[model samples]
Target: MTQDWNNIPTSHQIPHTRFLVDYFIKLPTQVTAFFLTHWHYDHYRGLGPNFQQGLIYCSPITARLLERITLVDPQWIVAKHNNEPFLVEHVQVTFLDANHCPGSVMILFQTPEGSNYLHTGDMRYTPDLKEEWKILNNICLDAVYLDTTYCHRRYRFPCQEKTIQRIVDIIQNSIGRDSHSNEIHCTSRHTLYLIATYGIGKERIMDALIQKGYRIYASPDKWKVLQCLEYWDSCLLNDSFTTEPCASPIWLVGWNRVAENVPGRLLPNFEALEDMLYMANYYRNKVNSSQHGLLQRVVACIPTGWTWQGNNREYLQEKDHSRLSVYGIPYSEHSNYEELYHFIAWLRPKQVIPTVSFSSSKRQPKHPFDHLLAGTQVKRAFLQKWLNNNPKESCEDDDKQSTQQLHNQPKIARKGDILSYFKASPFNS
Candidate 1:
C-alpha cells in the first residue's frame, strides 16, 4: 500500500504546482483511522476538523517532524515508530519504513473480515526492513496498492544505493571544488539557497552533505524535521548570530512571492549562498553548460513526481519549462521500474491496485490488474511477449504441475524486463 491519494482540491484551495495528494485524509469508515507516510504538505494538506473524531497514526519520527512544522499540539499526534506495529480502533497498522523518507511508512491493515491489505506509501525500492518483518508470514495478502508510477519499462532503473552514492559524489565534488567549502559567505548575503523541496530526495541530500562536512541549514521549520534524523543533534549545523526574528517564509511572504516581491530583505543567514556572483561560470559549466542558473544558485532541490522518467526529464528540461537556469541531475526517492516489478513478483500480490488523488470514487486501481503505466512499459511489454511464447495457464498439465511450467523463460533476465533508466543509472537519493 503506497498512498491514499484521494483528493484533487480545486486550484485555489491551497498552494503548489500540482493538486494536493494525501493518503491519510479524514474519512468516516469502519476502519475509522488513517496514517501518513510522511509529513509532506500534500499528505497533511486539507486535514481539518474532520479528523477531530478520528485518530492519526505514524512513526515517532513522523509525529515529531510534523509537530515541529506546525503548532497543532503534539498531544494529538499518535506515534508508532519503525519496528513497532500500531493498533488504531481495532485496525492493526504496522509501520514499515518506505525508505522514501526517514519516517515514511507502509501501512498493513487487518480488518474485521480477517482479510489483509498493504499500502506502500511513496516507498522507493530501498526497502530494508528488520529481520522480523517477514511478509511471507502473512500467508496471503488480499490486495496491494503499488507505486505503479514507474511500473512501466521505459524508466532508467538501477540500484538505489548506487544512485545515492553518485549523488553524494556529485555534491561533494561541486561544493568541495573550492578549497574553502566551510567558509561562511561574506560581502553579499548568501545562504546556500538550496531550494528546499517538499519531501522526496531532500533528506538524502541533507544527510550526504552533513557527512561531507557541510553544515545543516536550520531555519526553525527546517530545524524541526532535520532534528528527527539520527545524527541531526550531534551533526554540525551552520552557526548563526543574526538578531533578526526568525519567520516562516510561507507565512511572511509566500515562497512564490520571494523572488519577485522581496529579495534582499531576508536576513543574511537566510541568504547564505556562496561564490555564485564571482564563481558563477564554474557552477554553470559543471553541467557542461551555463544553463540552470536558478538551479545552480539553489543549494539543493526536491521535485515531487509519480513517474520517474516524466519527472526526471521535467527537471532536466526545466530550462525549457521556465526561465530559471535549472538543470536536473537525476535524483529520485521512489522505486524505479525494475524494483517495482521485482517487488510485485516477489510479493505475488493477488490483485494490484493503483493509488490516485481523487475523492468520491470507489477504491479501485487506476489501471486494471495489468499494471501498465508509462514508466514500466518496457517491462510490461517484455513480460507480455514472454508469457505469449510460453502460456502459463494453457500449457500447464498434471505432469508440469509436479515441476515448474516456466522452462524457456529466464526467471529473470537483464535485457528482458529492463527499463531505459536501468541502462544508465540516474542517481536516486
Candidate 2:
C-alpha cells in the first residue's frame, strides 16, 4: 500500500535515505512474494523493516550488489537473470532486465489462476541487445506495474554513449594529454579528490578511469560494493592502477551535509554553492596554475563539479566546471530522460506505477516500474521453468500464450481505464 511521500525526508535523515526501500507497501491479501528489480537504495530493501518471506527475485548482479550495498540478507536473495523464472509454488516469478544498472531485473508474476502481471522495475536503453530490447512488444496483458521514475518529460536524460564519451573526452583532455603533453601527471599534487556517487551505477566511471590508467581509490564502504563484482577481474586483476590504499579515504559526501562530520575526512565539491565557491577559488585555481613549491604538481581534479544533477545545468557546469587539468567528467548511472521516456513509451504498460521521487521540483504520483524491466531475459527462463514444472499442462499453458511474441507487446492505453486502474489501490492508499 502507498504512504505519504513527505515522510521520506524525516523518514531517513541520513545522507541517503535509510528508508532504503522507502516505506513498505502491503497488498490487501497476504504478501506471498516479493521482488527487487534493482539494488538502488530507493527501490530495494531499506531500514523500513522485515521482508515478507517467500521469493525475492532479482538479478545476479543485484544479488551481489544487494549483499554488498544493502542489509538484504543473502538467504532472501534469489539472483535470476533476465527472463529466468524462479517459482514460488503457485506464483511464477520471472526475473527480467530492467536495464537500470549492471544487474537490474524486472518481475513477471503469473498467478495460478492465469492472471499475468508485469512489474518493470527500472529500465533504460542499452545499445547492445539481441532483440532490440527483448523483442516483448506484443504481449497482451491484464495489467502491468510500471516504473514511472521519469514519467513526465522534464526528467529526461541523454543516451549513455553520447554522455559517456563526452565525459571521457573531457577527462582525457583534462587529466590525460592536453595540448601540451600526454602525461597523466596532475598540474598540482593536490589529491585528485572526487565526491563519489551512484555506488552501483557510477562504478563504470571509476572503471573507466582505471582503464585509462588513473589510480582507483574508494571509501571503505564503497569498497564493499567494489569487492562483489564477478567480472571485475578483467579490470582489476594484477591491474595495479585500479586501486590505491585508502585506509583513510576522503568522502565525497552529500552537499547538504557539508558542515557535518565526515568520519575520516569529508571534502565537499559542487554539491552546493559554498562548496563550489571553495573549489572554484581554492581547488580550481590550483589546477589552473602549474606551480606548487618543490611539489610542482598542483592538486588537480579536486571536484569543481559534483554529481550528475549538479552538472545537468548551465550555472553548475560553467561555475563549478573544472578549471584545471583535473577535468569535470559529467556522468551518471541512471538512464537519462529520453532513454527513460522512450523505454517507458516503448513498453507501453497498461498501468504505470509511481517510484521514489527524484527531487523536490520533480515529484510524481506515478512510479517507474516499466523502465526497470526492459532488457530482462527472464521470460525465456520462466517459460523453461514452467514447462519443466508442469510438463502435463503444456497444452493448458500454450492455450493462454498470446499470438504476440513477448517482445512485440503493443502498449497503447484503453480510454478511461487510466483513471480507474491508474490510482493506487484503496488498501495501499
Candidate 1: where is the Cα deviation over 4 Å?
1-26, 29-31, 48-51, 127-132, 136-138, 177-196, 199-201, 236-325, 357-429
Residue-by-residue lDDT tens digits, candidate 2, 186-261: 4333233344355565555555565665555454565567567665656546442323332111223332423222
Task: Report the number of clashing residue pairs per model.
Answer: 34, 59
Model 2: how large is the Cα RMSD against the reference?
A: 12.3
Model 1 is weakest, by summed lDDT over 10 consecutive residues, at 243-252
1-429, model 1: which lDDT tens digit per residue? 122323322211111111122433433233244466677675676454333534566777777765665544565568887656555545555667677777777776665567666677677764454243575354466556566555444454445554456555544444432255543231121213333345323556555655554443344545545566554555534432111112100111122311221111111122322333223334434556322332323333322232143233433222322222222333566776556655654455555555522223233322322332222434544676697874333222322332232222223222223222211111111
| lDDT for 86 (candidate 2) | 59
Question: At residue 331, what lDDT does model 2 achieve?
Answer: 42
